[model samples]
Target: MSQPELSEDELLQRAGRGDARAFDQLYDRLAPRLFGLLRQMLYDEKEAEEVLQEGFVQLWERAPSFDPERSKAFTWAVMLFRHKAIDRMRMLGRRNRLVDGAVLEQTTLGGSSQAADEALQDAERGEAVRQALNELPKEQRQLIECAFLKGLTHHVIAESFGMPLGTVKTNIRRGLLRLRDLLKGGA
Candidate 1:
């Protein structure tokens, strides 16, 4: 026997009444785009599929509580999918070395691979900074090491390095400016 199709409202009504076929139809309608949504926030394909399945399962479990008059069925499901995507991203973020935590969170929009590539580029730029630090000349580097690495005040660094405070400050500032220009491909 062939299954009869229903309008979205009827599907939601039946789904809310515990109709398994209606739930399956709802999952079929939502799953493909939901996978993409999860995948954008999480670059892992397997994890994205799992989260997509779990979102559908929760929709089944909670469908009875959903009020269609307040929101479209698709709208409700998409919001749940987006929430799960962010939840997964947050779990992944806690494990990674996030440089700009706010930017990382804002950019992981559950949307595109282009954004992911930009985030990777930013991380690469930070790695370049570390490499640049290692290549600094000794005295110039020592000023930075004491001021930033050891968290010492500039005056303390000047006293420790046995230099006029102004000279010590200029060495650190000019060294950093040179490093910035080098990283920008200008030096």
Candidate 2:
């Protein structure tokens, strides 16, 4: 007679007790499906693979804490992979934004200026906006730069700068209002 296959819960229970073989079996059964899910979320093959490895490592460490009352073992594992993939995506997005911002800043700095009257008018408006931005407090200016110029969300900016989300939002709002007032006065 053929040996019966162990169910996921059985495998998880065994693995939780520090059975390496059971854990290996669990990894073999779930890795492909979890990796596929991660790949779909991340949209990059290499990154998906890396996140898969990371997820499994985390699972190995956390297997002892699995609770059947809260979620199935499979669901818990999938959540780990999903969270890892989302974090990777956010990190990549932040990096891309920074690189794009740098490139744009370089392009603007090196741009050739036309001698036309319209070009002069546009330059003057740009200068006014820069002057207004410079007039704001340093903290407000930094928040505005991260939220507006770099296209970061308030939550992301808060995490990056280690500030509270409410504080970041407040600073951005105040900075924009101050900038608007300065522009109106200058005009």
Per-model TM values vs. the true structure: 0.48, 0.58
Q: Give the number of the best model, judged by lDDT.
A: 2
Checking candidate 1 for backbone clashes, the offending pairs are none
lDDT (10s digit) by residue, model 1, range 72-183: 8888888988888788677445424433443455456644575668877766765676556546765776677677656789889878878999999899999898888878
Please report how far candidate 2 places residue 58 from its true position, in Å. Answer: 0.3
For all candidates in order, the CA lDDT equals 0.74, 0.81
Worst 10 residues of 1 by lDDT: 94-103
Q: Residues 1-187, candidate 2: write the lDDT tens digits.
A: 9989998877887888899999999999999999899889987777788789888888888888888888888998988889999998996666455545554455557565634564556556666666676677768977887887678999999999999999999999989999999999942
